[model samples]
Target: MATFNLKTVAALLFLILSGCATYQTKVNDARNAIASENPEQAVALLKPLAEEESRDQLVYLLDYATALQQARKFKESAQAYQKAAQIAEVQDYYSVSKITASLVLTEEMAQYKGDDYEKVLINAMNAVNYLEMGNLDEALVEVKQLNLKLYKYRTEAKKNYEQNPYAYYLGAMIWEAQRSFDDAYIAYKNVYDIDPNYGPIKADLLRSARLAQRPDELSKWQKQFGESAPSVDLKNSGEVVLIFEQGWGPRKESRPENRRFPQLKPVYARTQRAKLEVANQSATTNEIFSVERVAIKTLNDDYARLVGSRVAGIGAKAVLADQVRQKNELLGAVAWIALNATDRADVRQWSTLPESFQIARMTLKPGKYKVKAIGLDAYGSESGEQMPEREIEVRAGKKVFVSWRSVR
Candidate 1:
């Protein structure tokens, strides 16, 4: 009876030892697969091990979460990390729990629909904790470090995106933050090639590509892309003056085709007495002549031309005003000073403005100012000219006004 009992005990011990050996072998294989970048295989091997009662479930769960994250299954990785954190907490593994929590938070942040910069930052801190754990292999430590950088980039990406949705080039920006120039180049190229207009994103894409040392790619894109669209130019050089006249015309949509020609109505005028500081010329010349006439087709066109002209005069100073039909009407008009152009100068439209009827006001320094009032018919055709070059002496800081009236 004693012999029989000993045999039974030895057989049971043998079976237990064999099971332990098999589990260890499987864990090693899973680790090897992950090292080889076969995360899918690693995950398959680790999933059953994680569920096995005899296995070290904590290790298996951590490995599985890492694999899931590598696979870009952020939601599932977050769940696994959550489980790991809970297990570590219950086991009184404070350090492990913190690291797992951080991983979970990182994954969670990646899944967030809105800005997650703070959460990503927190995750990066947790990754640092894992690095200090000493139990993880060097490769895993490297991954943790890489994750730290990725999270930071994600945070920055979210912030930039929030600030400017049009800056969707942020995807490439995040990749570039990871030092993955190839990935960043691809991402930026995608944004650049997208059909939707993203304001400055195209330029950003080109700039990033050039920074990545892809001059050929930038050149190719430049060849394909058109010139940058024009914008309003505003700069003031010297004491430039603009006198705006208020009037209304028929809407383009309401006008007949044949009658929709460019109008020559005088929108504003300047006296020959006004002075302009031309670049590189030492002498202040009275070459500025009174504007005999000006015309605009639409109110927005007029306003855009006016504002852009004003903005273009950044290097020059402007004392200007518009003749508004009423004080309230002046509030509706957008005003800007244009520099560089001498009196009697002909300036073309740079950008189109909104189409609407509006009023304006003009303020000028004490001086003799010449004003021209021109009118446009409903069809944008030049109605006969009105008040050609009216001269008025403006007191310092006083308001100068001019207006155009449409003939019936």
Candidate 2:
């Protein structure tokens, strides 16, 4: 039984490690295409791997869905996200204690249950897609799902983890659009409660109070903000809410655990903030909103716990492999090699995601205007030679939405 178990473990480890290498090679081309603003190319590259939902490649599905959305294929994007969510649902069976096999092998070997943030964001992105297509009812449904997921995660999160304020903020925006001022007020208030320092929520709370005709709430917010009710100036013009998704989000990399055997463990490399400039082409008026670095996903915490377990498992296996080697040199050699090979990091992630989300709003007379998001690097220098600019038509009494993704 001992010999059989060791051999089985060795074989499983070898397969898991080899799988990561194969997957990276397969996706490298697709990743580059996305960076070049050619999501169509990425979709073509990733579609074949994503066709089989039973394979449970959530990462592949996520990339495919993002590319489809970027290419303006909203319906197809939503469908792909739905399939990815289904695969992630299977992760519920793998309780923390049940992850022993994963620790002994590789995190990639475990079912790809999305992190809490990723789960909520799946709904959030779908909501954006639905809204962009002018499907208000469908967008509302997605926002409601996002809130419910956040509530559940909040209840289950460890003490160190906090609920996402952006999720609540987005829900509030949806309610505001629906003219459900009461619901919007409540959602905005929730955002305030989670992150009082978030500047945008302060303005939103005040606006919701005024719209809801809650005098007491209005007074409370005014005192909190140390100012009067900031006017929206929507009487003559419609509002354009410009959301800029700046740069490529963090990606997973493997690092050696120890100096000797050097068991590889996964870590995340977060992208730096891009200095963005928002401008209107007609008047060339611009409003600069600084991007806040929100911890949308707690990768550090997740990696710490995972790496700790992996280290213990690797150490135990190393001892056993040494014992087996003394008894039979060939078997021990094979076992040792397999153990090292399987010490691969879990590199799967939603790479197209932005490092941080930024928002800017402008009140413009319902007319056509060209809006531009000029990307700048850390040194306040132009990052993209050809800036990303889009033409938008703003209408009176309605909010126009524009989004730009600058994944440099």
CA-lDDT, candidates in order: 0.36, 0.66
- Taking all chains together, each candidate's TM-score versus the true structure is 0.24, 0.80
The clash number for model 2 is 0
lDDT of each residue in 84-157, candidate 2, tens digit only: 87776664575464365556556665666666667767887787687677676787788788777766666754
For model 1, the local distance difference test gives: 0.36
